[model samples]
Target: MEPMLPEESRFETGLVEVVGGYAELPSGWTVDTPDARDRFDVSRLTRLLRDHERHGRGWPGSGVDDVLVEVSDTGERMRANVVVRDGDEEIRAWGSVHDRAGGRMLFVHIVDRDLPDDVAKVCSDVLFHWAEGQAVAVGSARGLEVQQIDTGAFEDDARQHDWLEGAGFDRVRSWWQMKRPVTPDEATLVPSTDKWESEGVRVRLVGRGADGMPDHDDLRDVHDVLEQAFRDHFNSREETFDEFVHRLREDPGHRWDHWWLAELLDVPDAPQPVGALVATEVSSATGPNGSYVSYIGVLGDARGRGVAKSLLSTVIADAAGRGRDRVTLEVDADSPTGADGLYVGMGWETSYVTESWHRDVPVTGTPRQQG
Candidate 1:
């Protein structure tokens, strides 16, 4: 068997391949490389994919109609693979592809670590070139003046960093994954019960009814509060009502019991839901760790009003009440809102730091020429 390109050979291999303007892949096989398959724990992948499937965000691209494969000398062995023309230009490459409606960006999530020396080297070369090519294609299609690609989860790997550097990508920001113990007493600290009394804020924990679902009105109120609160924050993308609903319902960790809502008592008629928190319980399959906060947000008007502190106290208390051992959340190190200070005050500490690499495709058209 011989290696094939879109115009040559009967087969092709690598991360992506295009044939006659169509992109295709083998049956029972996915675009994920073999090494990726091994590196990501199967169970974690199962959960993540299951979450994606449940949420409808993990669908494969439609443009990948063309198929290509590479076979070894024995005709039965396969070495490398690539899928191309996956319809979604942003997704065609890799990373966390987000369709911004006007244009798209690709976020290459991970790379296979077990790639053969030759295959790995080739992949590195192709990844950079392909990224550049995709940018040009997008730029031509929609007059998309800009393109951005996120290099996901690169940690301490000089080789990977070198490849990205060689490819013209730059490191931008770092994210921290922090965890904290959730004791029954922590719930008392949330102040949902008392902060409201002192500050004249009305807070309530929306509960599930006989139907086992939270009240829609309450949920909508919380969404509005969060949407307004985060409007001016970094990456403050305006999300439609449907988008917000989709995001909430899609969370794999979403549980009705884990959400909270707060309103200002003084603004009874003003639609003042000043604060809200969304949390979920991740039952430890590996052990007995407690629930965690996947996300938390406070409205701008509600900031410095103790709304954030109250919300955290409430969440921690609730987690502790339910016998959870720990609560965890991720924070942007450079949050303009000073959320890090709030978390620290609440006893949350950083465990690990992860960097975010972004290549602004539109602002800078061509890849940064290697130095």
Candidate 2:
């Protein structure tokens, strides 16, 4: 509701396991990072993950999934991992272990860079070792050993590739990171409601509360819509309502006005929206502000009713109205809906590519821990 200041980036040096998302690293693996700060009491660790997850990253994400995926709303994914830090307490490396529901894949995301040689090695070691233990635990639970352990690095980071190969991760595939120039004409091209007025669907800016915050009930509906919408998409996870709200608020340019909720309006008692788009202002150190589509979700029932198009149009138009330089978003190269086609149709073009690399790791079974 209120404009937020960009937080100074700081290192959150420790380990954390989020509510439904954190999967604890297996026992017998020491918390080890050479020449690093011991700033990690449990309290500090808790705040670090929450802050890093909800805001620190300069992007939208829920819990652990934020760092690994291009677009995400958190859901039930058991996640746990550690961030290796330096003497200055900045991140040298970070990694996660997760039991993925969509494909029942035991997943890992490990990344590090720009650290002293030994520290860099420690960073890589932390990720590989944790992932190995996690793979074993998953295999034991599923009655088989894990066949692979997956990890990723930027496409051209030769050093990181060397680390991954040394750690036994393999190169998988590349994902495109696209950007598009937004002009007044493109932004203003939002579809009129005239066509959908009779269909009982209306997309409108989220109503504000008397206290001047977003009407959270509608906000929750937006999350619900997105949760339902992404059910068939890759890496779809059930992000907690709290995670959804907090993560969206993390961006400095978050605005209540930019959030839109689309409802099957004619449907009675209390109209529940079947679609939502959470858009935000993108602040630049220089140049005009830009716009971002934080999330665009439409219930399965609402697809083909023009809900997504309307939401996209509104974001572009809003960006143009504010005289922004451009608009941007990420798309999964493996999306089931061919979502990129829609963005391409709307004039977005690929500006760069990111890769997803993966490999199988062996795991030994251990007795399960009770909840």
TM-scores for all predictions: 0.65, 0.62
Scored by CA lDDT, what does every candidate get?
Answer: 0.53, 0.58
- TM-score for model 2? 0.62
Writing each residue's lDDT as its tens digit, candidate 1 over 1-371 gives: 11221121111233343212212221232333222333233333333323322332222111111111111122112122332212232112222233222333434433334445554554445445555544444333434566555554435556666777766777877777788887666656644532344476666776556877777777778777777877776555555554455445444466767777777778657646778888876656454556667657777766777877777777777777677788888888899988888889888898666677667675333432210
Judged by lDDT against the true structure, how good is candidate 2?
Answer: 0.58
Could you give candidate 2's per-residue lDDT for residues 1-371 as a string of tens digits? 43222131111123331111222322222353322223343323333444433332233223322332311223213444555544555444555554443223444443332345765575566666656655655545545545355555456556667777887676766666666787766644656411223366677877677888777677778878888898777546555675466556645567888888887776566666888888777766467878877778888776788777777777777788778878887778777777789899988897655566667655454534311
lDDT of 1 at 59: 29
RMSD of each: 12.2, 9.4
Error of 1 at 264 (Å): 0.9
Model 2 lDDT, residue 97, Cα:
57
